[model samples]
Target: MKKLLLLLFSFALFGLWSERNVQSVHASTIASERLYRLYNPNSGEHFYTKARLEKQQLVALGWQDEGTGWYAPVTGEAVYRLYNPNAGDHHYTLSAGEKEALVAKGWRYEGVGWYSAPSNADYAKPLYRAYNPNALAGSHNYTLNKAEQTYLTSLGWQDEAIAWYGVNLPSPLIVDLSEWQSPSKIDYDTLANQIDGAIVRVYTGYRADNNYQRHLTELQKRGVPVAVYAYVAPSDTLAEINAQATQFYHLASSFQPKFYWLDVEDEYLSGGLTDGTSIRDAMESYRLTLATNGASKIGAYIANNRFATFNLDTTKFQAIWVPTYGDNSGYYENNAPDSTENFALHQYTSTARLKGYDGSLDLNRLSGQVSFAQLFS
Candidate 1:
């Protein structure tokens, strides 16, 4: 009887301890949920998930949440919150203007915000909006129109004159050497001497391998500014493109280019990766890498066709080089509707004569539409 009683007591104690442990775990989970809830104490609003917070509805109103479920920072009358999975039960707040701006840029705010789950669980990562560097009517576009004309007038530009004059306009010209039949044969010294200041070109492995370094060295010797170009090929996979970018990064570091151009044109369209989402993703990744690698200060070169298809965030890139060639009038049509804010460097003549090149190559002149500082600085 004694032995049986002792055994029963032990069993009861074990059960009680187990029950308490279970209760403690349940309580901890409940507390954690509350602690992690996206709350803005300042705004007196709380969000259960990140999806709820990122909604276009919320973003437009300028809602922001503090990660601690504390007070949210408010701008105007709105408050915002964003759930961060990496933060583990933390919420972040967005200003009202930020929300409105995001919505205006075309972000779909929907779904449960974010929650902590098992590491193995699959969760949708947040998608960032695309960056369109060349918007039809932005301040840069407006400046391009006035600056180019002013510079042209200063350079003794006549209505029918085909003379080239140097105005020290401080803007880089958008040039493509792809059409150059014999880049190797051309005298780098002659071309460098003709162009004042910097002469930017699209540099690729194909071009870089074909005596690009030697040509760049020659251009440098002539005291002309040099920039390299990276063509984002459509046929290239993201991995391949990224690897290419890494190569460019090393080269840019060594060359110390004034700027780098992301040339997305024929090569991009010719290959299969034309889907908007894929293009956007690749662009974002590339941009992020550039930014991370301290190459964000560089510029981007885009043609009319790619400009129309991909929505680029102008804020991410420094300047836009647009190609629109035409008659002697020096006016060319852009794919997008005409606006004062269009392009910084406009390729008005593709068949312009160069001293060394046998055939006409894609020639572009600096448009005084905007000050270089306004477009780049």
Candidate 2:
């Protein structure tokens, strides 16, 4: 009788261990599933998916991979996916009532997108929602970040409350910076942690920006990556271009910029010289001068609408930087430059307001898979 009793006790312990192990395995599986996020610049739309293939397809179709938006579970409440045929945008929700409501308003229910976590689940996190009242397409926005939701509302976006529950939500990578965000204007200690890289203005076409050296020394002291750019006047004589580029290299070389960008704007043709030939000549002069003066990585900062009109060679430069602010709302709406120029970096917004900084900043992000090392190297 004793022997039988001991065997049964051992079996009960083994059963308990197996049950806990299975539960842990399920939890791991749920946590491993990530909801990939992407942005459509042309359409101002954001997309999320649990399918790697779909994410890859959209990325291949020119979408910006915004990385994982949140984490889903192996099984829970079904999140329905809907498509507005007329607007050409996608929407997802966890409520059957909300799904039907949009469907009734001409949104075709594609099917269940991904599973949401159970209410008040320990691993679950809230996904905040927002709506752009001014937009007819790509109106709704969802994020797992409360700060981002708050920022959007400050920019005229309406808060729509928590859309669903997820296990993980990541901070968006907004690494690029510029001269406008200076030590006097913003906290350097905070800026150091926030900046991935910065491009300070050397010359603004007619004269040098006074903060160029100060910004450089500050960034260098903090071990922050730095670059230099000079705004070139379109009607600038070959002599002026040569002198400015040379002066820029000589003074700024000690700080060791990763790239020397020539800012060529069509709007700043000195003396109203709109000749495309003169513009191209001025651009080329600055580029060639920089190259001759030992600047290894020369980049061109061109306005999106000036690609054809300015007649830029583009092949002469190592990298292309284009500015195209979709709404100029001071936030990146993933608006790609409307140009044929094959660009390496994008200056998305000139009015970005970063934490610790009170003034507007020109923010940039790399195009496609381009990296800091590749641009500099």
Candidate 3:
């Protein structure tokens, strides 16, 4: 009876051990499928998941699952995973301390087959950083007359020439009617014919004016692109700014200017208001406001010195219009190199000879001197 009892006990113990082994195997398989193992070639570090790697790298990094034969997110790469039986060999056993160490070294954790990163993981891609928001404003200093336009064309200022004088023509000076002494005196038909394909800028504020309306009508009739400029009050509260913007939106809805320009020159005159918030915070607020309001394109018009002096975050603005005179050469000539990189256009070369309705106006010119396509692209 004793011998029989011992034999039964031994059999029960063996069965328990076998069952535990099976559970362990199942757990490991599940973990393998749920976690993606990554090895950083540069750091010679292995990560159990992409999240583990990202926390360490602060950059977009990724890995692949060998068992699933899937590629994972990496620096500048999209997030995707695959499954392959061969990936089993890629798996590495790691202790808690090892995992922590890997994460500390900029490794990220990600899932294996049929698993994905957490929804809130920072999965944003890096974009081309803007260099200077006010780089293009200085381009307005040059003349857009026939000779000047031709010279600009030679220097690859095609977009500026078109925006200023209309068609990419080499000759035929189409005077800006608004700048004429008697805009109404000039025959609409003659002016239209001259500016058959010239682009024009119109100031469209909340205040209604016949001159602005007439110009809008004529420009629409001529199929020329029009852009509105609003002299924004920097100190104005959000409500006041929104009111002004809404008014402009309604008025220009029909005209549909390509975009709106927030003229931010003369900080004092326009209620010099600078947010005490950090530059990043201020810029973020501005950008969010413009974006939420559905402004197709928003730009800033700042003077050269102001841009240089103010530690403004230029990235918030789509494009910057720097008001510098004469070829934009010496506009920010004395200013130090800008660290913030956000610029699309440069308003260089203002012609002092031209006059607007109010008085001698600064005829600003833009140049393709900068890589605008790359900046905005």
Best by TM-score: 2
Give the per-residue lDDT of model 1 (tens digit) for 166-191.
11111243335532345566666545
Candidate 1 residue runs with Cα over 4 Å from true position: 1-175, 178-184, 197-209, 235-237, 267-277, 328-341, 369-377
Tens-digit per-residue lDDT, 1-377, candidate 3: 00145644654565587687643211111111112234444433333332323333522454332221111221211222211232221222113454445446554433222232222322211111111223332222223245645664556544332211111111112223232324455444433432212223343333643365677676567544456555544443444455656665555557766656666554453323343343334334554565576666777666666665555566666666654333222111222224233443444322212111222222233333343232222
TM-score for each of the candidates: 0.46, 0.54, 0.40
User: Residue 267 in candidate 1 has what lDDT?
Assistant: 44
Per-candidate Cα lDDT values, in order, are 0.43, 0.71, 0.38
List clashing residue pairs in candidate 2: none
Candidate numbers sorted by TM-score from highest down: 2, 1, 3
- Alpha-carbon shift of residue 374 in model 1 (angstroms): 8.1
> What TM-score does structure 2 among the candidates reach?
0.54
Give each model's clash number: 42, 0, 57
Rank by lDDT (best first): 2, 1, 3
Rate residue 291 of model 2 by lDDT.
87
Q: Between 1 and 2, whose TM-score is larger?
A: 2
> In lDDT terms, how accurate is model 2?
0.71
lDDT of 1 at 21: 68
